[model samples]
Target chain A: MRGFGVFTTIALLIAGCGGGGGHGDPNPVQPTSTPAPAVTATPIPTVNLVLQLSSSVGVAAASFSVGYEAGRGSFSGSGAQAQCQLGSSDTLAVNDDDAGTLKVAILPADPTRAQNLALPTTLTCSFDETGGTVTTAGLRIGDKKIGVIDGNGVVVAGDSSRLDVR
Target chain B: MLLVVAAVGHCARGAYAAGAPSCADPNGDGVDVIDAANVLRAAVGLPSTCASAPAACDLDGAGGIDREDALDVLRRAVGLAPTRDCLPHLQLTEVVHDLDLPLFVGAAPGDDTRLYVVEQTGHIRLVKDGTLAPTPFLDLSRTISSGGERGLLGLAFHPQYVATGRFFVNYTDTAGNTVIAEYRRAADPDVAEPTAARVFFTVTQPFANHNGGMLAFGPDGLLYIGLGDGGSGGDPMNNGQRLDTKLGKILRIDVDAYPTPPSGNVGGGDPDVWDFGLRNPFRFSFDRGTGDLYIADVGQDRFEEIDFEPRATGKRNYGWRITEGTHCFDPPSGCNLTGITLPVAEYGHDAGCAVIGGYVYRGARIPGFVGRYLYADFCSNRIWSFVRDGARLTSQVELTDDLDPTHALGGITSFGEDAAGELYVVDGPTGLVFRIDPE
Candidate 1:
């Protein structure tokens, strides 16, 4: 049990390290403590968001929706999908409603590969902030909709880090 | 290891001593889902409490403790009797072969020597005494549409077939509409009169796929038919939840009275609709022993489900567009589950794509096999069975490895039960009819 706690702490630390540049509010608090570092400087052209998925007994499939500030930012680039660091054969689909919700679903093609995945996998995506100077943008994961299935076809409890866009 | 051998013998008995702390329930806390999980953990070499006594974990007596052992314990955990001894040493014997795309198999009442196989191209072939009949019993290829989830899909003989010489068929017409028709046997017992095809009402299909064409006579003597949710994908028509349409429902009617629906059907729907909210109930069956109904609804993307309805219950709303296999589907999250009947058992696409519902084994030939409901998949060709203990589904064991060791049974499309309650599987691609037999 203690070893599992250490593994969880390490995963959280890795997620915390990614917050160095974008500096998202890890907690669900108001964006008051830290002012936008890039608001005064040259307006940040693009902001990268990192999503971390943590499961104890590996992951076979993960599906969740991300709701972001639509007025301040819009998903950019050719493929507008989160480039997930999953198995090469995994099926990944990302759909943007253009409003605020972005539905992301990942299903491993080879189930055994998912069973052998290392814990705490990461996915990264970028969006272009156009309107006014963008500060720490509002990001929320849909509740009661997220599902992370494990190797045994059982839906296991999983955790994902909060997203903050600069 | 005399003690180990004795333990193996004790565990392989195939009967669960009620409330006795056996290998499955090592700590005697009354086996539940946790014990089932622990056995699975041990099978994968993970840290598990059952790992301490691995000998006892060998539930099937297959020389070593593996996933099958864990599955057996899971059966016990879910209030089902042990089927450890019946798991292995089963084989599929090819009874008939070399035919066009066969979709279903059946036998008339009191007719044990002959089997009737339905081909998708609108012909009912006869196999008698292990010999294929040169002439089809009934042929309607010129009149019906065939191919890709259409055609003559279902056949069911009346409960009093011997006395009435009557049988019904479900097929898609040339205009792509579902047609339920009744036919009678000719002077010869083996041949059916093609001119006797009496057409019932026609159901206009919206799309090509998801044509749920399965016909069966319930124990109550009512003819039941399965229809898909108007084809396409994800039930876009929302026909599953709609009462105005009979697209995603199990329709019941009395053939003797033409279109008169029997009493005790769910109120306030299409008079023919007995139950609704099914995506594509490709296949369903009634247990000869318990008279319960089992419907295997193929899932849209992720899950395939097995729905159960008791003999006495009617008017069940199996959640379809609202949910798929016990999870929110339409709204995608937090959908209302009120007044909905969920599946008794479900598996994801990792196991199979489409579920082919099979019958409850009540045949006398296979010992310790009765009361278990068997099912298969079209894409995976994997055969699995589970015992339903009251409302819970227990003892889900995959019989693919033992039943089809050489993979001779290819792409199972449907299962057939003879008059004597013996089961046969229909291989659509290979046109092989395999009878499940004990080795």
Candidate 2:
């Protein structure tokens, strides 16, 4: 009986193992028909811009120009920049080269007092493409920058720059 | 003194002798008896330089002691305008009193009247005859919070305080709520104790900053309380324009009668909301003589405004969210300038930072400034005065240099007055008080 039982158990175990292998063995390995493509990074574009001021008072006229790619693209434009003369008539202009060079000039209507006026020494510019909101800070004419202003022509900020005179 | 007078009289009558310098001609111009008597009085006090016979009697400096000197003496005696040299030099007296926890002050109707000062942490002090009473007139500091800008921001004695002995106080509680409590002094006019305390109205403040704690009874006898627009910057919640919320507005309520019975029942549902659209009306006062109301509304930035409300008008809107001092401040619709009541006077941040409302000087002492309304700034220590004629408000003038410039105490938080119509200013930072008088 023992010999018959051992032979039957070994046969059942072999059948179970064969059934498990049969259920798990299908589609063990597969190959891809096509390969994925690699991605390439893009570079950002840069531009050199210049801003110029005309008359120093009463909605003073101003002009701006952009030079990009070593003079490959040169654009000259005119628009109003809310720049006013500090206590008198002063004007300012800027020239920028796509080669990373910026040149700024302050013209004083009253040249005799130009030395006394401190022209702004720094300028910060920022813009938003979606909102079209461009803001500039630290803009100086001679050694001074316009401090405060209202919707009216009244300048609440201090004006020590001789370049503010239009 | 009597013997000298008698000798002078004898000389004037020529009784002593004929050559007695003709008795110095008491009436040098030879006027009548009354004129001669006046001239004699004037010449009697002449010094030795002027006492050279007839020239001595020329007290008028008009060449003689004649009718002119007599008239001059008479004018001087009757309190009429005297000549420049004869005018008496005026002197001023300063009286400083030490007060314990002087919280708020109010004045009633008469001369030689008393001033009521409220001490934070509770207790009402009475300054009568320029002396503070030893005991407190009333005490309620036990229930007061005494926190930021809280604790007895305002006190108003009913116009008929003499008869009614009733007064009101606006204070903040432990929970940071503004309460306008009414109390009646005991039968004894001097003591504030033995009084009945009653809570007339209570307002729950969302935040502490803009509580608008000033309470004043307007000319109409209605209590007007100034509440700040719930205190965060920029009016983030839009509390000023919304009428349903009482947060940024000056509220008027009739405290004479309870809307409901003595029980906890409420009736008529707040018929007291008088005017709205205010940021934080720090201090507001009505002209004691005229009923016009002047409000000092503290602004957010760039501007401090003084709003004027004529007594005749009732419902006037002072634009808050939509406008600040006649200018568009917020975005979208900056300011609706059409129907809003504009401020009579406004100063930029350069001149003054915050506006402190003051009383209109109706006192008799300064007759020239009788109808003018006086106000000051907390930051710049500038004193300003405005005159309103009919519906027009004149430009304000700086009344600086009249009071002690050092008395501003960093910032002026409140202005008070005594019974005689004298004005006082309270400095918030230094906790000092100054009385404004004629220079």
lDDT (10s digit) by residue, model 1, range B17-61: 233234565333554433444455556655444533343455543
Rate residue B48 of model 2 by lDDT: 19
- In candidate 1, stretches whose alpha carbon ends up further than 4 angstroms from where it belongs are A1-166, B1-88
* For candidate 2, the TM-score of chain A alone relative to the native chain A: 0.22
Model 1, global lDDT: 0.72
Model 1 lDDT, residue A8, Cα: 86
What are the per-model DockQ values? 0.01, 0.00
Looking at model 1 chain A, report the run of 10 residues with the lowest lDDT sum.
A157-166
Error of model 2, residue A28, in angstroms: 99
lDDT of 2 by residue, B385-423 (tens): 656766665424444433533333456666787776767
lDDT, residue B298, candidate 2: 86
Put down candidate 2 lDDT per residue, A51-150, tens digits, no spaces. 3332233221112222223233212221122122232344334443323222332322222333112333222222112222222221222323322222
lDDT of 1 by residue, A20-106 (tens): 435665452222244557755566577766666555444433456667787876655322343334434444456565566665555
